[model samples]
Target: MANSPVSPSTNDDSAENAAHGKGRPTPSRAEQEAARKRPLVANTKEERARARAELQARREKARVGMEKGDDRYLPVRDKGPQRRWVRDYVDAGWHLSEWVMPMMVLVIIASLVPNVTVAYWSFLVLWVYIIFAVGNMIFLGVRVKRKAAEKFGAERREKGLGWYAAMRSLQMRFMRLPKPQVKRGQYPE
Candidate 1:
C-alpha cells in the first residue's frame, strides 16, 4: 500500500517532520506589526506596476512644485539650502587639493624651464580631468540623495546612503585607514 505524503512516519520525510509539528503557535502582536512595517518585496507584475505608478506620481508632484518655484517638495537644483553644504565642501576641497597642489607642483616643476614644458602642460590637463571626474561623482551622489528625498521620502532617501558610505570608505582607504567590515554574526548598525 502507498503511504500518505502528510504522514511524517514516512522514512523519506522524517527529518522535516522532526523540525516542525502539525500545529504552530501564532505570532505575537509585535511580530505582526513589524511584518506590516517591513517593505513589500514585489513578486508579481501587478505589484511592480502599482509601485511604478506610485513612483511616477511622486515625480510628477515634485516636477510641478519645482516649475512653480516652490521647492517645498522638489529637489533643490544648482542653488538651494540643501546644496549649500555640498557646494561649499566640494568647492573648497577641490580648490585646496584637487586644484591647488597639482597646479602648484606643475608650475614649480616647469619653473626650471626644462625642455618638457609641453609635457608639464599635458600633465596639468590630466590633473584637471581627474578633478572634474571626482567632482562629478560627488555631485551625482548628492543630487541622487536630494532627488530621492524629494520624490519619495526621507526613508527612501536613506536607501542610497550605503553608496555614500562606501565612497567615504574609499576616501579613507587612500588615507591608510582600514576598510570597514562585519564581525561574525554582527550586521549593519
Candidate 2:
C-alpha cells in the first residue's frame, strides 16, 4: 500500500541498492545529547590511555619516517631534493665545524681551571679556532649554494640555503636525520 502509484516511497532505489541499517536501534534524543556532552577534562582512565596510545603511535610513525627520509613524514624544512642533497654533501666529507663542538667543550673545561694563564691561553686559542671555523663554514656555504644552483636552478634557489647547508655540516655525521645517504668521500655529483 505504501508503494502505491499515489504515494512515492523513499526506498524506490531498493531495486538497485539494498538499504543497510546500523544494526542497532536508533539512539534516543537524551542519549544523543548525553553522548554529545563531554567533560572539559577526561576523568576516565580509558580516555587517557587511548589518548596516550594514539600520541605514541603518531610520534613513532613520525620518527620512523624521519629516519627513513620519507618525504610525507618529514617536516616542511627537511622536505625536498635540494635539502637531501645538502645533507648528503655535508655527510660525505668531514668538516672543521664537526670538531668545533668538541673543541668548545674542551675550551669550556680549560676556562674553568684555577690557573689564570691556562684560562687566558685557552680562550685565545679558542678565539683563533672559532675564526678559522667561521671561515671554513662560509666557504662550505658558498660551495653548497653554487652546487645547488647548478644542480637545481639558480632562480629557483631559496634564500639562506647556504646557511642551511652550513648548519647541517656543523652537525656530526652520525647525528644527522635521514641518516646520511652517502658515505664519507662519496660526495654527491
Candidate 3:
C-alpha cells in the first residue's frame, strides 16, 4: 500500500474490450522507487547551530532589504523627530508597579464611597491626585534616565532637556540632597 500507484480503472477505457474483460493497467515504477529511498540521519549540535545561524542571517537580510515606507513591511524608518522622540520615551523602560494597579482599584472603591465628604469632593481630589502621581512617576522615570545619561556624560538635548529638568527638579525637591555647591577654586564641580 505504501508504494501504490494511481488507479488505472479511472483512465480512458475501451467499451468493446469491456465485454472481453481485457485491460492490463500500467505500473508506475518511478513513484514506487521514490517511496523506497532511505530516511535522513539525525543532526549534530554543530549542524543545528549552523542551520540556526543561516536562518537568522536570512531573516536579518530580509528585514534589512526592505524599503523605508513599504506598505508590505512594518516601515522600519522613523517618520520625523517627534515620532523618534516618542519612540525613545517608550524605550526608556517606564513601567507602573504591581501595587499601583491594586491601589487604583482602591481609588475606584474610594470614589464610589457613599459618604459625602469622602466620596463627593474627595473622589475628584483623589482622582486628580492619582493622575498626578502616575504622571509624576513616569516623569521621574524619564528624568532619572536623563540624569543618569547626563551624569555619565551622554547627550542631554537628545534626552529632552525640558522634561528631564522638570523631573530632576521634582526628584531633588523630594530627596532634599544638597546640590554640589562648587566654589570658584573647585575644579571637579
Best by lDDT: 2
Candidate 2, residues 1-189, lDDT tens digits: the string is 477566655764665454564579889999999999979987999999999999999999989989988999988888888888888888888788878888989989998999999999998998898888888899999999999999889998777778988888788777888777778999998
Give the alpha carbon lDDT tens digit for every residue of 1-115 in model 3.
4987876565346575567653666558997788887647526888778888999997776565432322243343333333233333333332332134455567678778877
Model 3 lDDT, residue 61, Cα: 62
Cα-based lDDT for every prediction: 0.50, 0.85, 0.48
Q: Provide TM-scores for the models.
A: 0.26, 0.75, 0.29
Q: Which should have the higher lDDT, number 2 or number 3?
A: 2
* lDDT for model 2: 0.85
Report the lDDT tens digits of candidate 1 across residue range 51-142.
Answer: 99999999988766654435375343423433332332332232223344456566666656756877667677767766765676666566
What is the TM-score ranking, best to worst?
Answer: 2, 3, 1
Model 2: what TM-score?
0.75
Query: Model 1 compared with the native: what TM-score?
Result: 0.26
Model 2 misplaced stretches (Cα beyond 4 Å):
1-43
The per-residue C-alpha lDDT of model 2 at residue 71 equals 91
